[model samples]
Target: MSIWGRVFAAGYDRIMEGAEKSVLRAHRQALVGRASGRVLEIGGGTGANLPFYGDDVAELVITEPEEPMARRLEDKLAASARTAEVVRAPAEDLPFVDASFDVVVSTLVLCTVGDPAKSLTEIRRLLKPDGRLLFLEHVRSDDPGLARWQDRLHGIQVRIGHGCHCNRDTLASIESAGFTVSELRHDQLLKAPPIVRPLVIGIAQAKA
Candidate 1:
């Protein structure tokens, strides 16, 4: 990880606290509350979603690539009522068998991955035939004017945000990866910057 990556990881929880209280807390609770059977959460930064997982989840595995973030996630997992195995791994290269999980989750992570297509393909590979993928991601805005601004500032955003692209077309990437989107909702975050505020929260199933 780069120095900025380390700095961001160290302050991630503190930075996200306000957004968590305003909207993300509820969004995460609703998204993870429905997950069941074997679960795998990609990019489990600081274990923010750990508290929302339902009791019905048979097993939970969280993957975090950054050492600093993974260590913080471990601390969060240790205190949670729910038990999960925390592994240090990247989203594009998950170390799991095909069709190993019944449900997979991605929240606030698709934007930062080096290759969204590869990561989504991996998510599809890890899911069972009838498995579901629940995601809450910030995506490129549809508004032309705002999109222009996103395009303008994207480079700087990536440099400062630890590889997080502010204008990724995450929903389209999920579709291109062969996951049939079942439900999707678009909205802006309450306390986030406009460039990264446009969000897509939804569920998708791996194509059989």
Candidate 2:
């Protein structure tokens, strides 16, 4: 990680403390609680989702590209009940065999990946034939006014928020990557900024 990257990651937990307490903690638990079998989690930021995986999960592997963030995640995982191997790698290029993981997880990460499409493709490649993807992401809103604002502020958000884009049509990106969305729910974060509050939570399966 660069100096700026380290700087952003150093304060990441403190910055998100409020959101975690108010809304994200519960949401992450609910989403990660359902994972089963051999699992892979993309962008395990500060290991916030680490405490939520249930015993049904046989093995857990977490990937984080940024060194500073990965280091923090390792620290959190050290104290977690559920053990997980931390891999320093980008989502766009996973170092695993094809059809290896039963479940792939991405929470609040797609928006920040350098290439969401490539990342999803790699995720699909790593999944078993019957594997499913579990995700909780903030996406472009249906409301035109809010979406416009998201678009206008997206560049600035990326610059400051570690490459997060507030206006991506994530559902469309998922579909384009050939994942058949099986279950989807929409909601807003309890106390998040409007640009990033529109949330999409769901399960998606690799297209047969």
Whole-model lDDT values for every prediction: 0.93, 0.92
lDDT tens readout by residue for model 1, 23-109: 899999999899999999999999999989988899999999999999999988888787999989899999999999999999999
Ten residues in sequence with the least summed lDDT for candidate 1: 185-194
lDDT of 2 by residue, 13-57 (tens): 888888789888888888899999999999998898988899999
Cα TM-score of candidate 1: 0.98
Q: Top TM-score: which candidate number?
A: 1
Per-residue error (Å), model 1, residue 25 = 0.7
- Candidate 1: lDDT of 111? 97
What count of clashes does model 1 give?
0
TM-scores of all predicted structures: 0.98, 0.97
